[model samples]
Target chain A: MLEFLERIGWFVGLVLVQVLVLSHVHIYGYATPFLYIFFVLSLNSGIDRNILLIWAFAIGLTVDIFCNTPGMHTAAITLVAFLRQPILKGVVIKEVEEEFEPCISTMGFFPYLKYTLLCTLIFCSVVEMIDTFSFFDLKELGLKIITDTLITLVCIFCVEAVFRRDKSEERF
Target chain B: MRNLLDFLIKYKHWLLFIFLEVISFVLLFRFNGYQGSVFFTSANVVTGKVYQMTNNLTGYFHLKTINSDLVQHNAELSIQLEHLKEAYKKLTADTTVIEQMKQEALMDCRLIKANVINNSTIHANNFITIDKGEADGVQKEMGVVSGSGIVGIVYQTSAHYAVIIPVLNSKSSISCKIRRSDYFGFLKWEGGSPEFAYIKDMPRHSIFEVGDTIVTSGHSAIFPSGVLVGTVDDVGDSNDGLSYSIRVKLFTDFARLNEVRVIERSNIEEQLELEESVVNKER
Candidate 1:
């Protein structure tokens, strides 16, 4: 129950930050870091797939509602959620079969980095493609995808580092 | 039946994923029809309130710049007012022209003041949310303009908030013309930069320079004739090499947009009805 409440808190807090602060930050003219996807990316790997999908849908829809893009975020985040299990399995080598959240502490730095990078890239590409909804200008589309992915990667890593330090202190 | 139920349970996650994606696409493609439903938009009460509070905080930071802009505008307006006063004195002897001026004034539109609560420019279809809405007499198709120049037309409105489809959107096509040459075209945004847009379908023979001013043609009832839009920045040919596509540097900076005026044309309904009646008669 406590874990559920913690998850809910992170959900709301991330959405608020994304809507109020990060959504307005358009670096240059192309990149806007979608930090809210971090919630979906950080969900425990052992959770029920259906529940995970629902959680992803909820966060994505909340963001879409605020940003005025009806389904762009929802679709992208749901896809990320669906692929999260496979991505974790592919990136992280499990020493023991146990339920754990995917983060730097449990998965180690390099694997977690790979996991975050892959998920962020997928999420950014999907969202940007849906936002554009056209292949007319592949150059602009690729630029947006690459820039958005890189920026979001950097932000996700920064956030992960902060959270990792907090968790380590709590453990100590 | 047992096998089908077992299969459903087996691949339920895949089915759910497909179902949710399908719902998202439906909501996205059908968004045009759903504009009237404000629940999913920034104009909704909850989002509007949040954005309003955020704007209140951020708005303070923009005051210095806004004040300077207002001061410069005031100086220009006073100079133009002086010129207009001199012209009025010279034209006082012509009663017929004065009557015509009165008639033109009668056709002029009124403006409702509003502040920008939420705005986005990075999206392909950019939208801006303002504090005023239906209760403030803001309606769909009403032209929105900042102090500098044209902003956009109101796309949807709730009781206390409205969303504007700014010129940066790919779907936004406003009638604009070259100021000096009077050559007109449909202004379009190909969705890269917010600072510039393309005016397509201008005739090849239309004479316009790089720095020529572009203004609303007022072919549509939304914006009045001669409202400032932008200045021509570059010129090129259309895809078929038949018409000219001139690039325009939009005057209203969407990034720093804070306050705006929604132009309420007094005779818009009457004009629309008249035009519809003519179309119906022909049909």
Candidate 2:
């Protein structure tokens, strides 16, 4: 119960930081890193594909409502949440996977970094691309993808670095 | 029956997720004009108490600004009172020419305070998360403008939070007309630049000049007429004759956006009812 409440608190905090502080941050004309995905990432490994999709849908829909997309984020987040299992299956070896949640610390040093970087980069790119609908020129599309991916990667790296934690600290 | 059971067994989780999402979509389509009021409106004691706490938090921040505005307003009122007294005495001695200022005096604007929670800017169609939700008095189609300028529209609201689609996103388009010529066009983001959006469907015959102001046309219920949208940067005609491609520099700096106002018309219900009746009669 405490852990559940703790997760809720964490979600709330991410939301606040995203809106109050992060929303104000723009790099090279692109703003908002969408670190809120961390909420879904932080969920335990045993989560079912169905529940994860719903969670992603709920979260995405929540974001969608706030942003007013026709169902864009919902579609993207749902895709990633559905894809999370397969992606993790490829990245996390069976032995280390038992030890921790999916992040730089839990999945082991190098594996965690690789996993977080790859997952977040993919997630942000796909969401942004879908949201934009492969607009006018290929150059603009490429630029948006690269820029979005870079910011997302850098953000994840910085956040993971600053809030350095060991596997044991997360399991609560 | 057997096939149905098999399908259900195969995709129960997907079905469940779809069910919730459909519910969300329904809420989005159903509500209009200030869903935030619903939370504060409910007679339920629990919701009322929760809103009270949230309102208290908002009040703590708003007091100083509100107080200063009232103080200046009070000073203005005192001067007006003296003038009114003098006018009262003159009514018996002279003809009164002061016509009642009704429409122009009531410039409709309301400030809605909502906490920012989950927001995305990188997405092609971005969303802003606010602590205010359906229960608070926010509704879909109500204009969401930040301190900077026109922000976006309220898309969805839960019990405690609402989302806005900012102008930077491609999906948002409002009918805007050049202030100088009064020639109208549709303003849409091309999703290329943050500072610019394209105005489509303007004919080549129309004039296109630099630094012309653009404002919303009150053609739709979304915004009142003459809300400052942006300025025309450049205009070009297409090879074909359909429309001109004009670029606009948006007035709102979406990057620095915070705090928005939701504009609700007083006669929205009447307008909606009249439209619905017309449609029904046509049917």
Candidate 3:
């Protein structure tokens, strides 16, 4: 019950931070770090995939509502949630524990970093591609996707570091 | 049936994913297909309120700049007022024609002040939201202009806010003319830099040069005659080469725009009715 409330709190907090704060940060007129993806990324592996997908869609739509981007956010985030399992399967874990949440402290530094990097890249690509919606400015789209992905990764890393939990706090 | 039910249960997540994606795609296509659908747009009540609140917070930061702009405009208006008084005195002393003064008073437009609450320039179809709306006497299709120059026409309005299809949008084409000559063209914003726009359909023989001033022609009742639009920075041949397309540097710096006035042209319906009657008679 406490965990559920915490998840709810984290979701709202991330959305507020994303819409009010991060959306204003337009660096070099290209990248806007979508740190709200951290909410999706930090969900426990033990959580039901169905719930995860729903949560992802809801959060993405919420972000869209704030930014006035109709369906772009929902589409990109739903893509990430759909592919999260496939991506996770490819990442080999030596000692898999039940209900282990993926974080730098829980999953080790490099593995967690790789996980976030892959998710952010895929998410950012879908967003920028759908936004431009044509190949006319592929160069601009590519630059925006890459820059935004890197900046989002950096932001997510900082957030994870600040909110890092001790091993005792792990669910399993 | 039991086997099918089991299969459905097993692949429920995949089904859910596909369903959500299809919904998102529907929304995407629906919105992009229709340019001015205000239902899901930021001009909606809830989002409009949030943007207004955010603008209220951030507007304070721009107070000094806005004040300076207002002061400059006031000085210019005062000088124009003085000139107008001198002209009136000279005309009265010479001919005693009250008809000229009455004709000048016949201008039916009124300016309502408003602040831009939200705006976007990155999109091909950019929109600007102003603080005034229906309750504030702002109606759809009304012209919005900054102190510097033409901004756009009102696209949609809620109870408390209104959205503008500004000069940056591809759909925006304002009738404008050369200040020196009667040669006219339609101003168009092709994708790219926001500082520049193109004026197409000017005749090849039209007498024009770089640095020529362009202003609203008053051909469309949206904007009155001689409102400062832009200045021709480059003169080039049109795509067909039969006519000329002039690149203009717009007077209004949209990136720095904070305040504007919504032009309410009174008696537009009566004029439209008269024009419609003339068209009917011609037919």
Off by over 4 Å in 2: A1-20, A39-78, A92-108, A134-137, A158-172, B1-123, B126-173, B216-227, B257-283
Misplaced by over 4 Å in model 3 are A95-97, A165-172, B1-3, B35-39, B91-106, B240-242, B270-283
Q: What residue pairs clash in candidate 1, if any at all? A: none
Local accuracy of candidate 1 as per-residue lDDT tens digits, A1-172:
9999999999999999999999888878778899889999888778999999999999999999889898889999999999998888898776548988777888889998899889988998899888887425788889988999888988888998888679867878
Ranking by lDDT: 1, 3, 2
TM-score of each: 0.95, 0.62, 0.87
What does the lDDT come to for candidate 3? 0.84
Taking the tens digit of each residue's C-alpha lDDT, what string does model 3 give over B238-271? 8998899899999999878899999999977776
2 against 3, candidate with superior DockQ: 3
Candidate number of the best TM-score: 1
Query: What does candidate 2's lDDT look like per residue over B1-283, in tens digits?
Result: 9999999999887786677556544544343233432322212234333434554564466567656755886888899989986976677544343333333435454556764444455545565656676677777777876544477777655566666766766667788787788888777776656788888788767765889888887676777778888888887764475888788898776644445677766656666788889999999
Model 1's CAPRI class? medium
Q: Candidates' lDDT values, in order?
A: 0.89, 0.64, 0.84
Error of 2 at B43 (Å): 18
Residue B182 shift from truth in candidate 1, angstroms: 2.6
